[model samples]
Target: MLWTTTETNETLAAQLSDELRVSAVMGQLLAQRDLPTVEAAEEFLRPRLAQLDNPFALKNLRAAVTRIEQAIEGKESVVVFGDYDVDGVTSTVQLVSMLRTLGLEPRFCVPLRLDEGYGLSHDAIDRIFDGDVPELFIALDCGTNAHEPIAYLRELGCDVIVVDHHQTKTEAPKGCIFVNPHVNDPEDAPWRDLCTAGLVFKLLHGLLKSRREAEDPRVEGIQLKDYLDLVAMGTIADLVPLHRENRILSWFGLRHLRANGRIGVRALAEVSGIDASQEMASSDISFKLAPRINASGRLADATLPINLLLSDDLEQCKGIAQELDAMNRERQGIERGIAAEAERRAADEFADEPGIVLFGEDWHPGVVGIVASRVSRRFHKPCVILGADGDETHGSGRSVATVNLVEVFQRCTDLLGHWGGHPMAAGVSLPTANVKAFTARYLESLKALYPAGLPEPSLRLSTWLEVEDLEEGLLDELDRLHPFGQGNAEPSFGVRGVVLEEAPHAFGEGNFRFRMPAVNGSRTGVAGIAWRMHGVPEVGQPIDIAVRFSWNYWRNSRYPQVTLIDWKPSGEN
Candidate 1:
């Protein structure tokens, strides 16, 4: 599909380019993202640790820190309960590791994604409370909406500190210190969109500051920056917006990871085929590192990755990393088969519907979210993929930015047993009998929201650049905007009037790599590759393409090139 490029202010771009000594294209890209001044551009292009906001600014930090300090000083045990995914596991490890510096060994537990389910569940709590009742329990990446579970923990004779980043209900869990940004009504807070590990970092920072204020010597050697490796992995894997505070964390975190000191992180990179010497990006975390960490949680216990992250033994970390790698490969195989089946079902029957909801009698609950994401992207609609077991069904849904899945679920709450998550991604469970009603009501809600018509998916083009322009060191210039993800997307440029040198040579069944011939008055010969692109342009055809300029590494060096995002015949634009 051809993209609709938003008009950018040439005046602003030119001013920034002249002031900051950046290329015109980089200036335009920065302007489009709302960076108007030199200071904003500098902050974004080169984020420094000093740019991070004070930890005390986050709401409830003082109270949460005091509570944690009281528990530690009194020698009371604390249990760290976290969610099963990367964010959750990393959060657990971060808090536990920090607590150990204070002469306290904290017990922790993560709910099984396929069994005990998500976030402060009764089974996980029972498992944690089995041996001894802790003085305080900390819930990470969860417990924001877990009122009953929090109440139950209170009954178990311990106060719970809820350190999370998920959406909350009208009222937070009673009597718990709600450190979540959503519950705190944080206004214009740069760290409002923090992931669980990020929140844990804040919590630890607050604790460290409190201890330092009292002249506690134990806090001396605890460097919070040392933990950014885990923070970067969780931040990128959690898919939170990588701007503002998060950009700083991830930017520094990647640098720390490249230092290769931690056994688990280094082993994970090695087992996942990441070179130790190469400068890694956020994409490395998203595509290479995180999946291996998340694979253990998806298929088995999340504690496996947490153990790997916390392990100091080189051989132990390597063993765990290899096991995680094997599990990730297995996960890929299952995901591909399930995605193919779900896509076929959506194409066959869910085409006319606004939301696609599918359930299998024996689907693995672990992979449902990935399937929903694929289905939603393919059909350009909200998708809810469910797993049915006897009378109950568990599911996950992914949606476009325009549609609010949380609101959609609230309207259909009468039929759902429980549901919670952000606008773009959510989870739900209900009686198996209500699947039909859910399908109908979900589509109806989407229809009401978009009465005009369901909008087609369109890519956002950053700026227009001719094929010849890509050869001019733009990729290295783009490095200033490192660690692109949710908010900070890698720039996409439109290239026009490029002729293919020959019929693209197909390397795989669904992809091709070939050369583009020069245009009149241009020296733009370059290699191009398109994956799963339909209507493959024939030899000698003039094409206008939407592409992203990126580095393609070979022989231990990075080379600049353009990756095709979308394309059309030259006149289509």
Candidate 2:
């Protein structure tokens, strides 16, 4: 969709430059986020971890901490139960490491994606109870909405502390202590957008603070910043918003990650061939690190990633990293095949529907969510991809940014046997008989919620750039907005009336290439790639383009480049 900014808004942005006494570029960027006052502007520019709320702000914080402290004092066997994803693995690592430092016996456990299914399950809990680990289970990133299994655990006298960030239903599990932001007060802290790792980090902060107050200097030098790398890895991998506390955590975590990297991180980097000297970005974590970690759960046991993260041995870490890398390749093969099949089915089946819901009896539950996400993005609709096994059917949902999917599930609570997640992403399980009913109800609820036209996608441009401003200095100035992600995105500028002086270089025999343009009496090069646009651009045609200044850094190579977002040939001027 074509987008044009308001002249009044542009004037206000210009006025902000004068008020803040900063460059117009920076002022306009802040103005885009709707920063009204200078105080808010300062806070936005410099997010302090100290400015973050106390960890005790969560409900039942004292109860949860007291349980952990009792376990530490008694030397009771504690098991840190986690999920397969980055957020889950990191939470396990963070909590396990902290518990060990506090003189507690903590072992980690994770359910396999294919074999055991998602979150806290009755079978896994039963097995743990059999192991007889003093009935202490601290679940991270899971177990928030696990009503049945949690109640079963309670019957077994097992205590569960659920540290999660997923939205909860009104009828939640009767947990030992549920520390979720969505519960209690909504206005407690804006950091509720944090991933599971962020929630676990807050809990650890409380534990550490208590230990330090009791004259434990051993906890003094233990900087939680050391684990910011894991926090950054998990937060970015899970695709959490890089805003507020998440932004602060990631910004600082990325810096430390580059400097004092972990063995598993270094090994994964070596396998992926990423240099530590170069700064790590969110894309690196999402594409490279996260995939390898998640591959463990897809093809093998989820314990592999947990082992890799918590291991202190270098050789073992390298072995696990290489194993995960191998699994990632296998996972890619499966994901591609499944995604292709899923797309075909989606196209054939849901051609008329505004929302998509597809189920296959033979589909693997391990990778359904990722496939669903791909299909959802391709179709630009909310999707629920289901995989059936025996009488139980599991599904994952990915929604467009406009819809509140969790709310839809809340409305269709009767059809869903179990459901929990954020607004845009969710996981569900139900009997095979209920798939059609749930899908129909879900679509109906969505239609009722947003009867109006869906909002058109817009490219938020930071500035309107003329050909004259395509200088090395201007690109350098743009680099000030570092550590970009959801809240803080890479700055995009519009270059209007620019002629494509030459045919684009179609690189790698794929859907991307660079364009050579002649503007302002000079030959200025810009990188242009049609991600899905295979048709060639007409030579010598003037087009309105959205572009971002980017740097391609590799071994012994560094250069400025522009990533083309969208371009349409223009008749104006």
Worst 10 residues of 1 by lDDT: 516-525
> Best candidate per TM-score, number?
1
- lDDT at 430, model 1: 85
lDDT of 1 by residue, 1-573 (tens): 538887888899898899999899888988887787888988888888888888988888888999999988998899988888888988899999988889899988888777676677888888768868898998889888888888888888898899888886456778799888877856579998889888888888888888999999999888989989888888988889998889999899889988987889999999888876688888888888888888887789889988998989999999999999999999999988889999999999887778799988878778898899989988888899998867888889999868888888878989987678888998888889999988889888888877887677888888888766877478778888888899888888887877787787786656888776765566545667788777577788888888877777666776666677787888985
TM-score of candidate 1 on Cα atoms, chains taken together? 0.97
| lDDT to native, each model | 0.85, 0.77
Per-residue C-alpha lDDT of model 2 across residues 269-322, encoded as one tens digit per residue: 778767756766777787788888888887678788787877878899889989
Clashes of each: 0, 0
Best by lDDT: 1
> What 10-residue stretch in candidate 2 is worst by lDDT?
1-10
